[model samples]
Every structure is written in structure tokens, then in C-alpha cells.
Target: MKTFARLVDDSANFSSDITYKKGGSILSMIETVLGKSVFQSALQSYIRTYQFSNADHEMLFEKFTEAAAGTVKDWCERPMNVTRFLDPWFLQQASALKK
Candidate 1:
């Protein structure tokens, strides 16, 4: 989120950020980042440098909303509203396993 905010800091495009990836294989993807802990620590340092300003989740969310709406519909996809967990994003193909 910090990197994203910095990338668009020049523009008031935070309101339109509609990206919210699901929990499908995100855990696996996160595991691929070997030095994630180190990266997170560095990020925390940056956060601390600005925490005194009271800029936090709520403020970030507000900016994100502005960015998303400013961009075209294809810029990013919105989160899905589901009545059940039967969606494929949570499912894996059994045939993909060699066992």
C-alpha cells in the first residue's frame, strides 16, 4: 500500500482504487517472497516516519477511493460480493496434482 501510494502521490487518484484481491492462492504467492520479513520491517520504518501525522488506514482508504473512480473501469477490478464460498478463486483443480 505504501509503494502504491507513493507511485500516485503526484495525482489525486486515490479514491478510485478498487483492487482487493481475494484469498485464493495469495498465501502461496506471499510465501514466494523469501525476504518478506525484511521488506516489512523497512516498510514499518517508513510508516513510523509519518505516523505522527495521524495518517492511517482510514485516510489511506479515503485516498484509494478517489484514485479508483478517477481511472477507467478497466484500471482495476472491484471486490466480489458473494453469498457463498463456492467461487473458483478458493478452489484448486484436483487434476493439477501429480499424485
Candidate 2:
């Protein structure tokens, strides 16, 4: 399985199953982890902060971490950096399934 952010080569087919299905599943999982309210708020902030501009995963994760400050440890039951917690999910394939 490829990661959600896998690099595409010139010969890549770009299947819809990967683009839509897996993408949707990953997004749903992220929302579930953050809770709907925090997820939505961070999403809105990300959009507003980067509308009509380019933004990367780190930027989005920063907003999530900011929104989740203080409460993240409670939710995760340990102190963790949001970006660190999510990096493996975006950087490697099949890792999310293990959790």
C-alpha cells in the first residue's frame, strides 16, 4: 500500500481508489482522532490562513496542534506532538492500520 502522500512518477496511473477512497478514509480517521469540533476548527483555520495559496502538511498540522493544545495529552493519554504523531501516517503506508 502506498502512503496518502506518496510521490507520483510520470508513468503513474493515479487510480481513483487511491485518490478518493483511501484519501477519504484517512481524512475520516484524522477527524475521528481530533474530534469533529477540533478538526473542523483547524480545517477552517487552515483554509482561511492559506486560501488561494500553497500550504503543506506541516502547516496544517501546526494548526491542529495549536487547536489541540492542552487537550491533546488528555485525548492521547500522553504528551505528544501532533505533527510527530501524524507524520508516520502521512509519510509511510500501512502504518495507520497497525494502530
Candidate 3:
């Protein structure tokens, strides 16, 4: 499976700053909850569940979400009527959707 292992340290902060926009602000979300290993398990779950079936990115994500919903169902839900995503569906659509 392909892996995006790019990492940055303090000394490379300048480069990180310049390059971060390319990664869609995910660095902040990930770094905020850095030690949450249970959430990280989604990677292994994705690799196991959809590695062979879905070859495209969209299909891959759909399969990954399905797997995560099975394994970590609670994290997969976004606030619709519930207080999940901080924003509603329209706002979520307006906000950066790449992540």
C-alpha cells in the first residue's frame, strides 16, 4: 500500500508552514490529538479491509469509512442533528472539504 510518511520537526518549521496548505490543514487536527492511537487504527483497518477491492481514491475512502464505522463507529459520525462535527452539513460543505 502507498503511504504518505512526510514528517516535519522544529528546525523545518518554515518549510512546514509553506507546505502545510498542500495537506489541507490536517496537520493541526492530527497534532491536536497526537497520542490518540485508537483513532490511528483506522489506517490498519483501511489497509486490511479495502486494500484489494477498491482501487480508486473515492471508493477507497468509502470503504475505509465503512470499516471505521464497524471498528470505531463512534468517531465516524459527524454532527448532523447531534453535536458531532462542530458545524452543520451546509457549513461543513462550505468549509474546506478536502480533509
Candidate 4:
């Protein structure tokens, strides 16, 4: 989420750098923990469900958990600390979990 700008903090020509984004790693983790098919379907459903509506993180998680049924049932059903689960990848500027 680094910004592309000159020395000045208030530079008008500022821009964002998406090169170092973590969306790919996040997707890979979700796919690996769940399954490619489930992940894809979940994402598709999420898109369709929220096409014209605003969605929160909880809604996305619920969709994924629902869609992950039978594919990664155990993992999806197991309880985990949501904050700990999401904070690393989302809060950190440059971080990606291998597991």
C-alpha cells in the first residue's frame, strides 16, 4: 500500500503502488487452506451476492465458510481467532503467510 509521490507529503502528483499488494498471496492462502474449486465458487458467489450491495468482512467470511463445505469442511468448521487470522496479512504493509 505504498504511495508513489515526490519528496513532499502533500504532493499533488501522488499515486498508489499496487505492485507490492498482497491480494495474490491472500487468495493463494485461501485456496490452499480451502480448495481451488471452493475458493473460486465462493468468490463468484460473493461477487454475485454483493454486486449491488455493500459487504463487510464478516459477510465475506460467512460466504467463504458456507461455500467451503465438504471441500475443507474440517478447516472451515474449526474455530480460530478472527482478529489473529486477518490482522497479519491485512494490517502489515508487506506480509504473506506460507501456511
Say which candidate scores most in TM-score: 2
Candidates 2 and 3, the one with greater lDDT: 2
In candidate 4, what are the lDDT values of residues 9-83, reduced to their tens digit?
A: 643332445433456666677678667787788889989999999998767777777786554644356643333
lDDT of 4 at 70: 53
lDDT of each: 0.35, 0.76, 0.42, 0.66
Writing each residue's lDDT as its tens digit, candidate 2 over 1-99 gives: 866876767445656456567667767877887789988998999999999999998998899888777665644486536787777777775455455
Every model's Cα RMSD, please?
Answer: 21.0, 8.8, 13.3, 7.3
- The lDDT of model 2 is 0.76
Q: Total backbone clashes of model 1? A: 16
Candidate 1 C-alpha lDDT tens digits along 1-99: 355534445354434332123332432332232135533443455466566776653343233333333231321344312211122333342212223
- Which stretches of candidate 1 lie above 4 Å from their native place? 1-18, 22-34, 54-99
TM-score, candidate 2, is 0.70
TM-scores of all candidate predictions against the true structure: 0.24, 0.70, 0.32, 0.57
Work out candidate 2's RMSD over C-alphas.
Answer: 8.8
Segments in model 2 whose C-alpha atoms lie over 4 Å from true places: 1-11, 74-76, 94-99
Query: Given candidate 2, what's the lDDT at residue 6?
Result: 66
